[model samples]
Target: MTADLPLRKIIHIDMDAFYAAVEQRDNPAYRGKPVVVGGRPDSRGVVATCSYEARKFGIRSAMASSQAYRLCPQAIFVKPRFEVYRDVSAAIRRIFSDYTELFEPLSLDEAYLDVTVVSRCRGSATLIAKEIKDKIRQQTGLTASTGVSYNKFLAKIASDLDKPDGLCLITPEQGPGFVERLPVGKFHGIGKATEKKMHELDIRSGLDLKRWPLSLLVQHFGKAGQHYYDIARGIDHRPVRNFRPSKSVGVEITYPEDLAEPNLILQQLIDLMGKALARLTAKQMTAHTLTVKIKYHDFVQITRSKTLPQAITGVEGFEAILADLLKDTEVGVKKVRLLGIALSSLHSPELLHYRQTDLFAFSMPSHFPN
Candidate 1:
């Protein structure tokens, strides 16, 4: 089925250690040194991103800040300046606009561009990618890695093949063989748990996955099995969408001191929910589901959720629901270190008014506002 479709030229661009690079570029002293961005070493926060120098010392994003400190004691820890990063990201998007309007931004640091019909650089996807990389460097004083391929899946994989200012191309002729030799864990959507499950099933690489019958793969992995089956053959038909909507709005806080009092915990939840409601309102959307999460001091975590028939517009609308959800958890009986509230099943009121069933779609990263 995929063979009959026309080949599309896709390019994936990823900034190298984006946050840490921005910090280094802004501060000359931090250049060539290991820089960790996110939280202070003594705090309970985790590393958001780090410089390449820090990667050599076994530091990585999402590692505990204290653990990162233990790995590289000399690594400099700094808080993320999102405002500055957003500005730089906007500038990079402008550069993308010059090449093609079919670009889809995956995050502030990376995007997928469909330049299949673009005539820039004599319609060479590789040259277009190179020009975009050069423009980003000239404008932002930062480096980006680009991967060019016939599909999004392979292009994204190719982008990560080389790092810290590198460019790589994977042609249609090389896609199948390239995927065959790759490890199952290296596939983008295959995480640790799924990779382990695949290993237990004797599916250790792309070749192994390709050998599984569709019926057997679906029996084990359900709907995602089809994706695995397709990508193993170097096939992905998904297009690059320019406008992606926000899937959910959520906020969480990790307190410096654990809360054992029910009243205090309730107050904190209210405060967090208020922030999330404000974000929903800002986006002109309402949610039908509300969830409350609690992480106890010993790291036992639990969540309770409710789906309402009507959209939730404000915190007052769900105050009772929040209390009911909290009661279901052992919040007062346990020492709570984190409290989070998330609103999902979101829809735009304007769209709902017209009875549009297809809700707006976007990506919202989970935020830890502690």
Candidate 2:
């Protein structure tokens, strides 16, 4: 099906150690040193990002700050300055706009750009990628790695082939062989759990995945099996949408000390919900579902959720739902390490009014984590 569509000239650009790099660029003292950005080493916070120097010491994002400290005792830990990062990201996007409007931002640090129709640089995606990288370096004083390919899947993969300040081009002729030789674990969107499942099925690489029949793959992996089949053949039909809608908004916090009391847990959830609601409102969106997540100190996790008959317009709409969702969990009986609230099935009230359609029939899970 994907083969019938015209080939796209896509480029994926990812900033190298974005948060840490911004910190280093702003503070001269942090240059050439192992820098960790996030919570303090003594706090229950996780590493948001770390410098390449810290990565050599086996430090990684999402690792416990204490563990990161243990790995690199000399690592300089600092809090994230999100406002500065957002400002830099806006600047980066302005650069992207100069080349093509068909760019989809995956995050503040990365994006997919479809330059198939762009006439700049003689329509050479490779040259455009190089120019983008150079412009980013010149504008932000930070390095970006870029990958140019005929599709988003290959483009994204190519971007990661080299690091820090790399520019890789994967031609149409090389795409299939590249996928065939690639490890399934290295494929985008295949998480560790999915990779483990694929390995147990003897699907160690793209070649092995390609050998499986689509029906059998579907039986094992459901709808995602089709995606695996397509990507294994170096085919991805997904477009680079410039105006992607918000699917969900949420916030979570990991506490320094576990809370055993129900009231304390509820209070923490209320605070998180408040933040999530504020984000939703800021986006001019409302949600029809509320989900509460609790993680025990032992890493055991459980979630409780409720769907309303109408859109949730304000905090008062979901405050009672929070307590109700908590009742379904072991919040009072278990010592909680993390608390989260997610508002899903989001819809812009103005859009709903314009379409004059009911939004209660749909529900989607929130993808963002605090």
Candidate 3:
């Protein structure tokens, strides 16, 4: 794995408060106020993004906007300007392309770039990150946090260590000790339920986590346990893969806590479906398979999926299909820690049915909005 490691300098860059920041930048009056970009609290909505000002009041993205309002009543909320954000992302991407072709965009707000042989940005990865942040702020009027490290895992985690215009670096020579001092929950792959399970096992930090045998971890958490073992040692070999001719397209996240409420969990699924659909449409592709993953409190994970008769690209339709699939509580109430949805068997956009066959009859008219 070490031999295959990317010798090229890889950097992860994530925009701070993407949607909210854009709103604040475009609308000068929204500055310094708690700005939320998502649906309203009155309509069973959650925050998609919020400004750092709002964060001071403990408001965060992916949380109920009502909760944000309760936390910071002075916050200004706005609907998502996805098109504007995409245009901005395109502009930022054009900057990265100036450096190298080996760019992998993780999201509209974040990307992984390999500047190995390229030297256009001056100095090393650290310097490049600083320049990139400056350029993004100068051109797009948005602050970005950056991570410079050998692998994707370290780069991603390092970027989050300091946020809202942060730049963090982790060298390969720094190695396992860096991870050892890391909190049990702070390890890249270890999330809420896994951390709790590790705590039960008397493994409360990265150092404490290392005491356990790798074989034992495999026995407990299955494949993920092996991943933990590797990451704890600062060894993540997963390469940055582009979505070139993809077999599948999907999005998912591991929550900070186990979701005990079924309704709340369903909402998470809807959100994931929305993101996956965005990716699908952006890529101009369709799917013939749908997979829903549930990671239980006990660290056991099960994925339920279905292969449709025809390729599907409709975001609302895909969500409906997922809701239908999830109607049966066969997985039971296990206090899920992670829920993800993915579509597979991808085909070209032309090969798939992407048009409105019956536009007026559709329940989600906005799905094909001009």
Candidate 4:
């Protein structure tokens, strides 16, 4: 037994239903409504995440708005305020910096902070977590849940045990036993799909999971199977990396007024595509996924994507592909309203760097028969 395994005190903090919380914080009128955030249901938009009130009516993020409408027609729907959310995320990240240099943000609303190596704040992780929660609520008018344990797995799982202004700390003594009794779905990194697979294997619970042979697990589940064996006994060795670089860099625009002209739309796409392609050059990355998002006047939205065989790393090449998609969309000036171009499958600047060429005034493609 490695008694000297560096004892870590990690805190996982997640804001309670972030976007909806912001709406409630800003508007008194929406406080009690079943707030659904994301694309509008009538516009063929998808749910980002619904408030608990909306969730009660069987709404969730990634579900179609029509389905959600069928479930709860009376729910209040709102678009995502990502700019405000990003600003709030920055403010909360600042608080983490005050505690330790070892902060790892999972998303806009969640992060894991390792406080074991701190020389100044000497006390229980629980106390620091409580103080952080207090500061967040005071500064942002938002509530967050905290989970503290020796490793990230235990810490993340512990945080979810109690949610929406909850704190849980799992000591080594309690960690293993807790994992044994945990429902398979509660394990970190276990998605809905994996939970179903585990169910088929008769791994109804963590105790049942612990009974699977290592070879069989590896045969069926590959590397994740090995990960399963370790967390079943509450073991995780991943470190917190805070200066994490962004993978893809792109820009988007929402039409204050819905556009209808084809030439006007294509011209706008050119400008937007120019900016996005320029960003790829600035970041010195290759984009594997080229996504063209079209939002209609009625607010119904559709996103089309093409993952290329070759990684695109320049303005001219990527923009050409984007223009092709735009031209083929066939949703002409009358119906088409907003266009957004995004590039993903990013290669780090470490892998590549900015390659610049002065070619902004490229000619428009000759495809549409006038």
Each prediction's total of clashing residue pairs, residues at least 3 apart in sequence or on different chains, is 3, 0, 0, 1
Candidate 2 residue spans exceeding 4 A from truth: 1-3, 250-291, 294-328, 331-370
Which residue pairs of candidate 4 clash?
43-300
In model 1, the runs with Cα more than 4 Å from the true position are 249-370
Which candidate do you rate higher for TM-score, 1 or 2? 2
RMSD of 3: 9.7
Over the stretch 1-370, how does candidate 2's per-residue lDDT look in tens digits? Answer: 2546776677788889988999999999999999998777776556778999999999987566788999999999997766677678777777777766676666567777877777777667777777777888899999988887777898888889999788887777788999999999999989776999999999999999999999999999999999999999998889877655787888777666777878656655765665566556544578998888889988899988888888876555555777888887777777998888899998875874331110000000111010
1-370: candidate 4 lDDT, tens digit per residue: 0466666666677778888888888888888788887666666555667787888887876565667889999888887665577677667767766767666655567777776655433456776777778888899998888788878898787777787788887887787898899999988888766899999988977788788878888988998888888788777878866544556556556654566656555545555554565445433456888788888887788887888878765445554666577776656745765678788887765653422211100000111011
Candidate 3 lDDT, tens digit per residue, 1-370? Answer: 2765445456788788888889999999999988987767775566777888989999877787678889988889897766677677777776665555666665677767755555554436776677667777898888888877777777877788798788887777665778888887876656676788888888887787678789999998898888888878877777654445677788777766667766566667776766676666555577888888888878787788889898765545655666677766444467887778888888875644432110000000111111
Model 3 residue runs over 4 Å out of place are: 1-8, 252-270, 281-340, 348-370
Measured against the true structure, the TM-scores of the candidates, in listed sequence, are: 0.75, 0.77, 0.78, 0.70
**C-alpha lDDT score of every prediction, in listed order:** 0.77, 0.77, 0.71, 0.69
Worst 10 residues of 2 by lDDT: 356-365
- Residue 176: error of model 1 in Å? 0.7
Candidates sorted on lDDT, descending: 1, 2, 3, 4
Writing each residue's lDDT as its tens digit, candidate 1 over 1-370 gives 2656777777888899988999999999999999998667765556778999999999986566778999999999987766677677767767776666675655567778877777767677777777777778899999998788888898888889999787888877789999999999999989776999999999999999999999999999999989999999999999987655778888777765677878667756765676566556544578999989899999899989999998886656565677888888887788998889999998876753421111111111111000
Tell me how candidate 1 scores on lDDT.
Answer: 0.77
RMSD of each: 9.0, 8.7, 9.7, 14.1
Highest TM-score model number: 3
